[model samples]
Target: MLAGLLSAGVPFPKAIELADPKDLPDKFRDFIVLAFELGAPLVPTLSQLEVQMRHEERTSQEIDQAQAVPQATRTLLIWLPVVSFVLAQIMGLGTFSGILHPVGALAALLAGALLFAGYKISGRMLNSFLAPKPDPTLSLMVLRICLSAGEPLEKIRKRLEGYPDGGASQLVEISKRTGARLSFLIDSELEQLNQKLLSSRIEEARKLSVRLLIPLSLTTLPAFLLLTLPPIIIGFTQ
Candidate 1:
């Protein structure tokens, strides 16, 4: 609707005012209006948003690839206790009581602790995609857009109060500088910022798979042993 209105030659601010950002953060309502008043073009902001969506898609694919095996392993570990119980009953071992005997009870208690630990680990693994943090790159890109248009850094900071999480560190000295040379400088800074953001995400994904292994070995493996090993030994001895 905003695009259609803009195409129909409705003034940019009026077009934005007429269009509602449903389900979006209300802070954006003021942020976008401020951008228009600063003479920033809608095209650049939309282009940056496009870049972000693409990046998120790529990141999500990476997360799924990284999480698949760990998730399967976790599911198997979590359910082995139920399977162990059924197997014991089928083999003529006294069902829950055989597993609930004093020593067996100790084992079950330990297994419960490990199950809880494994649950926490799995939650963290899954949450990498589910609970997304604020993207620092987004605010940086907006800074680039507004600064390239010659807006002052102080004004940008004031407008960004409730927007993306970012700091004034990068733009502090930048505000004092100006001229034809500044365009090249901004381009270099934007490139560096993009690289930093991409690299951090890549590192995080790489670490996730390695980190999940600890919980699997420490908690899930022990959990499986607690649920299955005792019954097997008792079944053989009896």
Candidate 2:
């Protein structure tokens, strides 16, 4: 939509003004507006940004798909014992009757607490997984835009939200030694940054499979046994 508007010679800020806020992300709109203010080449910069955003979106979707089965299993692990206890009581199996004893009541409370803990911990794990990964290329991206716009490093460091002083200095040093354009060097770094982010995401997914197992064994399994065993023991004794 932005590319079409720009191609048709709509004024950059005017094009942005015309867009619905819901249709455009605030950060993206701000980036476009700032890039225009800095006199960066809007078309190519936006094209590159679009490609990166699409790739990140696809990666996120893939991670969510990978998580589906584990999430379902977690739900089942959480609910299966509770459902069994309910059914056992309904079927006149004396499940709640067994829990009417002082000892049984205490056991039920402990099991309930464990089950709740497992549920809360599992949710926290999922929240951490969904949290945004730190972008290694943010400073480089800002530098690229600044260099393209002929903005000074001091100006960028002061004005740009995430432009890092260290990264800017390193890029300048490399440019001086290699006689390379800072823009060109930053582009190469951006490519490598994408590859690094991909690898990091894969590692995170792998670790999540392991992290999820912690609650299953430590809390959920114990709760399941605490709930399940009493009924079985009672039936055998009867």
Candidate 3:
């Protein structure tokens, strides 16, 4: 809508006002408007930004989809033993009588504790995946877009808050030393940022595959044994 409106010759601020607030962050919208006001080209810049945002959204959704099966499996792992015990009782396996015995009661308590610990630990691990953290590269991206405004370096730096002093500063320095265009250098940095972001996502997914095993081995397996074996042993003795 932003690009379409820009192509239709609507003013930048007005176009932003018309666009959905949910589609863009307030900081980004303000920076884009500032860039345009500072003489940056509108349609091309916004079009590229729109595409990047869409890709990020899609990537986030893909990560969530990737997590779905694992999440469901985790729930099942945490509940399967309890469900089995109930089923054994329902089937007249004498599990209730077993559970009434001292050893069976002890096993049940231990199983409950293991299940609780596994649930909490696994839940925390999974939540870490979805935790919201400020993207470090976001500051650089904002700085890059704002740089298009063609303002004096110091003046632009002052206006933009949270501008990273590392990559953005180096790109600006390199542009000055080599007499290269600052905007072009920033675009290259943005490309590198994209690659880094992709790599991080891949690494996170890899870690998730391994991290999931911690709960299975540490708690769920023991809980399963306790919940299943005692009932079977007691039923046999009875």
Candidate 4:
């Protein structure tokens, strides 16, 4: 059905309207909706659309995989304390006896909680990393600089294609997707993007984040050694 729509040069939104929701894959539905809403231009080169679709699908699958694993792990972690307590009781070990004594059991419960919390925090961080944050003014400035240096839009896009973290490249990609004129899009969208980035408060947050990383990494090594060295030394002595 999508192929037929492409052949007929039907707009994506209209094609989606014509398609049966039950017949369409859930993953493709959002892309279809976005295309329709944005009125994304059709690339003459069908191969480009194919590649983009595949990349998006792969990314979606990877995110699903990550979410699935963590959910399953969390469920198992939640059961640990309950299971440990039960087993101790069943084995006739006093509540404060066995490897999982009161203190050890408390530590286990805390570790499990920390693990689940860490996973949730990391997932949010990963989503933030993946979502595009194109700054329109900065993008326009970059484009103008490139153009002044004798580069065309297409050439500039190609040059920045490999700049994975570039805000300008993200704006260009949005233009490519929407079939909008890059310059016009940049001018119209710059203010909105700037507002969003500012409201997110990421700049101040990033400064603090960067300052923490070095100290965090530095502290980790000594802490890890302190925790592990005694066990290693005891094993060797035995």
Q: Against the true structure, what is each candidate's TM-score?
A: 0.64, 0.80, 0.82, 0.34
Whole-model Cα lDDT of every candidate shown, in order: 0.63, 0.72, 0.74, 0.47
lDDT of 4 by residue, 1-238 (tens): 5546766889867765785544545434543443344344433222222443454455456545544543454345344444554555465544333323444444445544544554455446545644654433433444534543455677767654544333677667887799977656654554454455454444434443444334333433333332233323333343
* Candidate 2 structure quality by residue, lDDT tens digits, 1-238: 5666776799967866775434655556666667788899877777766666666677767777777756876788888778888887787777776776665677778889998998899888878877875665666666777777889878876664654332656777888899998877777777766777777777777777778878876887777777767864664455
Residue pair clashes in candidate 2: none
Best by lDDT: 3
Model 1 Cα lDDT, one tens digit per residue, 162-197: 556654344555645533454345446556655666
As a TM-score, model 3 comes out at: 0.82
Greater lDDT among 2 and 4 belongs to 2
Stretches off by above 4 angstroms in model 3 are: 10-18, 33-41, 90-92, 159-161, 164-166
Alpha-carbon shift of residue 70 in model 4 (angstroms): 5.5
Count of clashing residue pairs in every prediction: 0, 0, 0, 0
Off by over 4 Å in 2: 8-22, 86-94, 157-169, 235-238
